[model samples]
Target: MPFVIAVLLAADAVSLMAAGDRAFAARDFRAALFAYQDLTREDPGSASVWVRLGETYARMGHDLEAGESFSRALRLNGKNASAKEGLAASRERLAILSPPPKPVVDEAGARERYTAAVRMINERNYRDALNALDEALRKRPGYAVALVARGSARMGLLDYDAAAADYSAARGSDPSLASPLFGLAEAYRALGQPAKAAQLYRAYAESPATDVQPALKEYALRNAQSLGSQ
Candidate 1:
């Protein structure tokens, strides 16, 4: 009975290998991949089975998976020439798939977009201001002034959530900047977060930035006091 069971298992393995080979030869790589995957699960110790799975993955343009499968085969049998070749081929293909990093935008280009956004904001054209700010931010991801401006534009458009996000980001990028704190306070107030709004308003009023005019500080303090009363 034991001998019979062993023979049956061996025959099943052979059948799966043959099925995979036939599918591979017919250019049905998906079917080949499934068959080989099953064979690998059944006989994980077999380097040849892993090699077949790796080959199917390569044919299907799954270079990363192919490389992993080939690496597994190499671990099982360090003498696996097919696994070595497949790993190298996968690496070559992967390198081709990955493009070079984008070149950094020049400072002047980012400033140009930012200047346009400021002009549009002054004209009360919040929609066009947002478009310009998007380009500016893409060119310079951590532009604190631009983020503050974008927050104001979002406010004008009644996009309170986005305004809050931009204000928060601006504050994070330049903690000492009173403009972002004021913007963030207003955004929080609009978002119904009164406690946060009050805290930020007080902070903006107390900020030591010389550009924060006396009238603006007085207004911020008034808002903070009003929210505190609530």
Candidate 2:
């Protein structure tokens, strides 16, 4: 009777582990979360189970829970790369959600703000241009042109990292767009990453022709400098 009982428990454990793995493989994150949660409750010593739970929480956007799960997994297995990566990503998402407060504006105000940003950029007022762009983004998220303009303004201010992020955001909004790629190449050049700058410049050069010749020329000059510096 005791042997039968032990066999039944072992079978149940195997079933639970298989269910968790199946849910994770299907990318059914919520289901994976539930399955892993149950498995962890039954087998708290399983480091792989904790890591899988963390990944599911991360995929579901439960950053705090994900961080905790990853921390637990790391405690169980210090060399777990997926757990470490999930923890880092969750922390980053939490940081973004709780970024320092800035002045807010409405939708119409965002258009006005972007117009002001453009005017300021034209006048070489880099600081004010960025501030205006920030205001615009607060009201209308994912404004690609505003992001590109902000990147250009940041380049003028020599803030290469922020410029790169803005240009990247712009490109993400429109992958085939050349302007953001040019901006990214210029930013990479400023940051002294010549190889990456050259690659981006090549991408921009091969992009479809638009009224972007002037920007392309600017990128070409930076790419030349990057190559010469190498």
Candidate 3:
């Protein structure tokens, strides 16, 4: 009975996907959006459906919504090229609306993109935030905050290798910033470099995180003592 139900659901998904494709090809994006929305609810694990939904939102000039969908798709399957492209495009589209980079300390374009990335992160749309931070780093290669945020997003995506690299760069660039210390420690632990992680956790525990996130300082203090003991 379960096997028959699965087959029936799959067939329904196929039929709905065909309808969405037709609507998309005809440029009836509203219809396509509706179809894809239904499909996403019916087949929530389908990365392709989420990607199609994102594409429809993009065509409608709803970059934020598009980004959310693309991020969800990537969460389900990070290797989905269409979802990756859609996420990047969504970030780029929003970045274009802001003023151009100023060539000074606060490059306006980079700041805009970085802010967009933060907004996405706050929404738990880590993939979109990662894409935006990548764009921000391209604009300002030395943006430590963007690097740190990218590390956090990569950590969310379970890309520990990239996360470690980004956190290390950010930590090297600005040793005073406390947030990256915790994040770097986290990445190192994930990568099986417990010694490196423990050191950074100690640093994080000693930093002035009480001014911003006292909870982080306490968490770091625990990790600093626990990683070595374990």
Candidate 4:
């Protein structure tokens, strides 16, 4: 009777482990997690079980739990690659979840505010231009046009570092935005990154255009001159 009971328990553990493997293979992370959780409970000494559980958690975006499970797996089987990979991924996910210190705001309303700021900058209203750009960014997060305008405004104000940051953000939001790329090139040049500026300028020159050939030619010539100076 005792032997039969032991065999039944073993069968149950094997069934759970097989189910977990199937779920993992299917990329059904939630189902895998449940199955692995059951297996881990049934066979606490199984390091592979813990590794699978950790992998499932990581796939499901439960970084903290994944980390803990991976750690436990490593404790039992130090050479486990899956556990090590899960631990690394979990740490990376946790790092991403960590909030940065600075506040970033850029949105749709930023377009109007940035346009106004550009007008103010043209009129030599430096301080007002800065304030308007700031307000625009505060209202619209990740507004590429506003970022480019703010960078341009900052450049006029001689705030080179801030201008570079704004230009970088603008370029990041839309890599194909020609104006922002131009602004980045100019910003980099101003900041003494002449090589970087020339590279960006070259990119701008090589980019395809939908506009008139005359404008494209002029833009290409300007970038060529800038690159030559570098």
Candidate 5:
């Protein structure tokens, strides 16, 4: 009877997961949320389920709930990649939602904020660095240096999507900045989008303006080879 009960529970979980996937594919995040939430109730220890729930919450713009879900997933499996990504993204969104300090309004003030963020990054305090970068950007929306710095901080936290956005924005705001190419490639790699990463890495490797280091080029080339389209 115990064996039969175990089999029944496993089958139910599988059914729930299948339903959740279908809902997610259809872009009905609320349905996905319901299915994943039920799955967690039935199998509270499933780390992947918590990660899925976190992702769904993030998609629905509930940053607080998303963070909580990611936290649960991390508690279950400290090394869960999806949970780590979700947690970092959630943290950024929560910070963005908060009220910003009075605008610094001066280039020198923005530079000061950016320098403070750099110090935070050096200390490995990524979250505080993000806050500082956010303030810097608010003071100077087109500050390419601050954008790149913020992207670096996000990358350290494994928040690949946000990092990619920051890099892309920096590149757009200042076309002369070749540094964003390398940072953008790294973000794509972390997000498991190897094709985009490889393409950008190859561009950086081939560009004379950006190819300041041969070792970095070799490293990028090897990564592209390892993560081929096949």
Candidate 6:
């Protein structure tokens, strides 16, 4: 029975490793991270698994986690060249004082598209608004305001999943931007994720008055209260 259990565990590790590799090759960092994390839990002593986790974290720009994972792999197997390389790379990234500069973009054209999207949204033409926002994002990737507007357009079109994704991207691009919180909360609510919705609503409500309008804050608080009851 012990031998059989060992074989099953080995099979599970093999399956997870394959899944992680496939996800990593496809640039699906989130899925790769999940599989690698599960591998860490199941086989903590596997230096290979730790190295793979480190690679996934590095690809996702999580330098701190990558550094830690690489260190763990090196500790488990001091001769692991991959772990050493990853550790060195992560350390270099960590040592950088400021982030690299962004690529030059046509800001004027992007702003024009964003303005068109806002106008379309005001007219309730969500489809057109989405198209304009897409053009704006294509011109200027990581445009936080355009992302928020796109999220709103997606919400209007009942595409809650896409809306949530856009809102999440906007939040990542500009953590201090307050609009994504309310938009993301509404998207979560529409997607039936009441807990996440409530959490975001509470966050929106608690934002400084200078950041969030009084009426929006009041509305967010009311929604938070309503969702918390569920």
Question: Against the true structure, whose TM-score is highest?
Answer: 1
Report the C-alpha lDDT of model 3 over 1-230, residue by residue, as the tens digit.
Answer: 59999999989999999999999999999999989999998899989999999999999999999999999999999999999999999999999987887664548888999999989988889999998998898888889899989998999899999998898898798877888888889999998988889998898888774333787778888888888787
Against the true structure, what is each candidate's TM-score?
A: 0.58, 0.49, 0.51, 0.49, 0.50, 0.55
What digit string (tens of lDDT, one per residue) describes model 5 on residues 69-160? 99999999999999999999999988988998765467887899999999999999999999999989888878998999999999999898
lDDT of 4 at 89: 85
Off by over 4 Å in 1: 1-103
Residue pairs in candidate 5 whose N, alpha carbon or C atoms collide under 3 angstroms? none
lDDT for position 52 in model 2? 84
Q: For residue 193, what is the lDDT in candidate 6?
A: 95
lDDT per residue (tens digit) for residues 1-230 in model 2: 59998798667878888887898899877787888898888779878888888888888889899999999989999998988988899999999999687645477888899999999999999999999999898888877888999999999899999999999999898675778988888899889888888887877776674736876666576775667567
Candidate 3: pairs in clash:
none
lDDT of 6: 0.94
Query: What TM-score should be assigned to candidate 1?
Result: 0.58
TM-score of candidate 3 against the unseen true structure: 0.51
Q: How far is candidate 5 from the true structure (C-alpha RMSD, Å)?
A: 20.9
In candidate 3, position 72 carries an lDDT of 99
- Provide the clash count, candidate 3: 0
1-230: candidate 6 lDDT, tens digit per residue: 59999999989999999999999999999999999999998899999999999999999999999999999999999999999999999999888946888777879989999999999999999999999999999889999999999999999999999999999999999899888999999999999999999999999989763568788999999999999999
Deviation in Å, model 3, residue 192 alpha carbon: 2.5
| Candidate 1 backbone collisions, by pair | none
Best by lDDT: 6
- Those runs of model 4 whose alpha carbons end farther than 4 Å from true positions after fitting are 1-109, 209-226
Error of 6 at 29 (Å): 39
In terms of lDDT, the poorest run of 10 residues in model 6 is 207-216
Per-candidate clashes come to: 0, 0, 0, 5, 0, 0
**Cα-based RMSD of candidate 3:** 22.6
